[model samples]
Target: MAAEFDTLAEWTAQVATDLGSSFKIPAACRGSGSLAVLDWLIDELHLSHGGSLLDCGAGMGGPAAYAVRQRSVRPLLVEPERGACRAARSLFGHPVVRASALALPVGDDSFDAAWSLGVLCTVPDQLALLTELRRVVRPTGRIGLLVFVARSSEPFPHPDGNHFPTEARLLSLVEKAGLGIEDWRGTEEMAGPTPEWQSRVEKVTAELADRHRGQRAWQLAERQSQLIGQLLADSTVTGELLTLRRR
Candidate 1:
């Protein structure tokens, strides 16, 4: 029988299953940005006990789980991939909804705050995603984002399914979406993973090698990660963290 996998979301789900109780370690390192980045956003969003948060495009429920763990907040995860949704439920026991960011299933003013990490580049309709966020979050609610902005107009190799926006274009989209910028920061270099984070990732990698070293799905996911790393390293893309308020 063929190995049951195709997308990076599947690979991430497998990793989450293998990690089991320690899933949050690698979970903290992936998708949501580093620990430092998460801290900044969580603090700026003012997440506290009993508060509600909506994680847009939450893959495998890593960052959302981390937020719940750190702040005791209630979290709802919105992910498009089925495998990821399943993994997120198993890994963190949080409510996972399989849906697109452009059209969330929840009602208006549903969440206290909303955030998307490393997800803006993947969606072509950036304005639509932001507008959806603005609608779901209450008026004056905060919306945090970690986006990879294009460094130049010159054509550059980017991972498949990505539509990175220039900094000016991203800002314009936020304004059109009815959100006002509250805080902005440029992360010139991605922060290095903490020691625990590195160790946890290595553990997952070792298990993957042991289980499916040469599988096509694994290779494809690895290639995608490498391509993204190269883009960040060569200054082809720059990371931008923004905190916006629903207007």
Candidate 2:
């Protein structure tokens, strides 16, 4: 029997909780797009002060390493997936632990900068994740995030899922989570994607496909590529960073 589902929210809730290697994202897209976002996030966090960084859900260490390399900041990572934690450690030997966003295994108010790079959208309790981040950062410290959103429609719930919060909704989530934002914006306006990005993606896809053999994984990758390519080609994502500061 096909697995039964009650509502889109039900599926979404599951996806938000899941952290699998084969998410609906092309590895190439996740990497390059992350690099682009980090460039801007780094600049913003640097102004406030840049050290003792914590990267929530540091999958593959690409983003952390990128931040360290470009911004000259070392990042401690927390991820729920043992696979991701191991993979990240193999690549950089940075400090990373297997943990969930809801319960961080760290002391409170210890970090100067904390960030969630494409990590917040999944966890069932957005408020819990945000609160943990807030708890770990000093009052004036900063938190950066990159999450998925939709306007009229929310994301379908798979193991690895997304949430599309309205601007007002997002602010509420942040405030309730016990933190306030500093600055936030959409990638399409300053960063996102361009037509020429495909040239880069095409090159990367060819190199990785042979290594990644699962059919479902490959198809999901293709689908996400199309969606992001479209998002890059033209800004279509409903969610945009609504910059905030903790009160």
Q: Please give, for residues 1-247, the per-residue lDDT of candidate 2 as tens digits.
A: 0111112112222232242323212231243354456678777777332477888877655567667766677679887766566556644678988888888899988888877766665566788888888888877778888765544344433232445455666778987876666777876556544445444444345544554434454556455546655653443443354333467
Candidate 1 structure quality by residue, lDDT tens digits, 72-117: 9999999887777776776778998999999999999999999999
Model 1, position 186, has a per-residue lDDT of 74
Pairs of residues clashing in candidate 1: none
Could you tell me the TM-score of candidate 2?
0.74
Worst 10 residues of 1 by lDDT: 1-10
Worst 10 residues of 2 by lDDT: 1-10
RMSD of 2: 8.0
lDDT of model number 1: 0.80
